[model samples]
Target: MPAERQTETIDGHEVSLSKPDKVMYPDAGYTKADVVGYYRRIAPIILPHLRDRPVTRIRYPNGTGTRPFYEKNAPAGTPDWVRLATLSTPGSSKGRDTADFPVVEDTATLVWLANLAALELHTTQWMIGDDGETRRPDRLVADLDPGEHTGIEDCVEVALLLRERLASDGLTAYAKSSGKKGLHICCPISGEQSDGDVSAYAKALAKELEVERPELVTANMLKKERDGKIFIDWSQNNAAKTTVAPYSLRGLGVPTVSAPMTWDEVEAVRELRFTPDEVFERVDEGGDLWEPMLERGPKVPEVEAPKRRKRAARPRS
Candidate 1:
């Protein structure tokens, strides 16, 4: 028989946790409660990134050994206190309507999602306003994907080069591992640039990187064209797109975390791939290294601003 369910009060809100004893990570024997505990510990740094953003959770009911499915809309039994954002995007593959995705603004909501075995917390780059309208991205991500037989080491070197290149161009870029094979170098896109503008700019930047290091980097998304090179994927900047949230636990062996890191840490691959325990301890020591990504409005150099509307509409709040 399954373990008994329990109700816990978090942030003055009641959240019912079911089957807390179910092992979500078999290798490490980490139960559903362990996942909740991890999220609770990392909520401070993670929740800020998720505030007002619609989340698409990757659920693994039978642990990492089994197949996982993407869930966009919050389940019907979501707590009344947990907020929801009705977005107009491509719904899930299962044909479920995701016009409403659960928003993780507080610890209670974060822990609630974790208990559902939502191992990968993928969130949109944009933020929602009071009227629930999602806007442009605050930062642009260059997902450095390495091709065939290559590893994180290649991505690390490319990330360092990209960092310097962006700095010389007058933009600040931050690096973090994808908790898998690649490194994601995020550049802060400030001012008021539309999603299309940011996406085009990122594509241009990727093309320039490809031009500079044809032997080591390729902007081609095709697998056939990219062999032993890092491809800078610029598509993650789309308004309808989402990427794995930093500090969220990935559904990998032993629960690897999509933790944030500095440029120096990127130089060291071992430090980049942080496990659950290491991530918790790292937070206990260094605080949140990626907090700069959330505190927007730093005037990114040469940002492409959208044109003034012809309709004389109200300005962005």
Candidate 2:
């Protein structure tokens, strides 16, 4: 018989977990308790990245293979210790009804979310600031998505190109496999820019890359035009937009993680992937290589936008 609930001590905080023995990864036979435990083990390192960021919980109540839905506003009956951030639309605090979002403060709250089957943690690049109402983004993400016929290798190629381009602009970025079929390259900033500004900047950079390497990259988001190229998804840097947090487990059949990687590791991804236990090991040995993501802001100098090029007219059939 399966257990109905569990009460575990995590970081000295007692977390009440329901459906502890419920199968959350059906094929792997891993239970909800197992995922909670994983989060508990990784809480120390992963917690910092999640600190202050409003999280969007992607829950799979039954199992990873079953139905899942996104929950941005934390559900009812949330504990007091688990902090919540409220932000109104257009990034204001005074003009409208506010929505309360959960902020992960410690391992106990993390365990609670995990127990709720919040397997994928999606957070904004920005945090609500100390003054209590600022939505300025501190990170920029360039999501390299491959087309139907393309693969991770293509994304890797484009990512390397982007890495070089960002370097020339005096900023450094960290790369991580999306734990599925994509790659997310991120740059930590000084938290001084609006979400709109960062979004526009990402779009401009993607457009610049598209113009330079038309055959390999495309800013066009439509599926038909991206059959064999990499699509630079820049829309994720917006105020309400959220990307998967590093160390979050993806519901991709196996317990795959959105693990961080070095440039060389990305180049040789075909050789191996960081598995669930493997990621824990990586943290145990190297600490968070992604720590640099919170280190400094971009040193980008202002540059004039590139002029649009006129494409040659197509001949009539």
Candidate 3:
């Protein structure tokens, strides 16, 4: 055995590993090499979804990359299925090694990886409840965010209202924090639907809410017009737009903003009463609520014809 290899247990799984060189993987026996190995092993399962997607590096508070495990000159035997998210940094500055991984594929996968990564890293700083499962989201997620506002309570309220509306339509929806300042509400839908179809559905839903509560929601793409209301941000479903990765930490230095919650809890916390510190404490206390939610699929409504809208009167010619 290599002198650096050490023995340890993770979630009760006994394994031998080396010490981590970076602070990102702080568990005693983990290393940047181990992180790379984990990705390589899971590459076949992960790459099909990740390849070709551009990845963003998560930076430390000091504006340094939190280098995770990835190789620049991946060996020939390295499966083409595995692709590096970005370049790697060699050493640490403040006695902390850094590492980076590929950008997450989507919001759902992001959550999945975040939970798993948290477990793997043994940070105790993050937690996912026992309820979180591996089931894929049936509903599409459209994240509307105004980059400036850090008070997420308003966004949470919007998501709850939207969830209520969708439920009234017989469609089930789920919500989670983006791990930043916004909220993400995922509705169960057939992935078979085209982007245009999904976008149209989202727009209709947003318009319905706008008409009902004109004081709060705005579907306008123009920032100048959004004012204090939440933008419906249907563009998130657009092929080019990206939502925060599920488990990836964001902001200046904290772990990613997106955290999963039960629909009931989502409604309860609509007031955004909890601080990130509170969220971290709760996560440690209760664990993730998403696993169980995965078992229960959304109650999708029967397909119906799109409702027609009346055209606005044109000015006299």
TM-scores, all candidates, are: 0.90, 0.90, 0.53
Can you tell me which runs of candidate 3 are displaced by over 4 Å? 1-138, 144-151, 268-288, 292-317
Instruction: Choose 1 or 2, whichever is better by lDDT.
Output: 2
- Candidate 2 lDDT by residue in tens digits, 1-317: 86687687766767788988888887788888789889989998889999898888899988888889888776888877778887664553334466788999799999999988999999888886886578888888988888878877788889999999888877788998788888999998878777777777788889999999888899888989898899999999888788999999988666788899988888877732466798998888889989998775863444455689999999999
> What are the clashing pairs of model 2?
none
Cα error of candidate 3 at position 173, Å:
1.2
Worst 10 residues of 1 by lDDT: 297-306
C-alpha-based local distance difference test score of model 3: 0.47
Which segments of model 1 are wrong by more than 4 Å? 1-3, 90-98, 297-317
Candidate 1 lDDT over residue span 1-317, tens digit each: 76578889999998888898888988989889899888998888898889888899999988987999888877988989999988666654666444689999999999889888999999877788667764777888889888996677778878888888778767788877788777788876673767887787778778888898888888888998778888889899888788999998888857888878877777766545678888878788999888888866444445555587688767998
TM-score, model 3 to reference: 0.53
Misplaced by over 4 Å in model 2 are 90-97, 271-273, 299-317
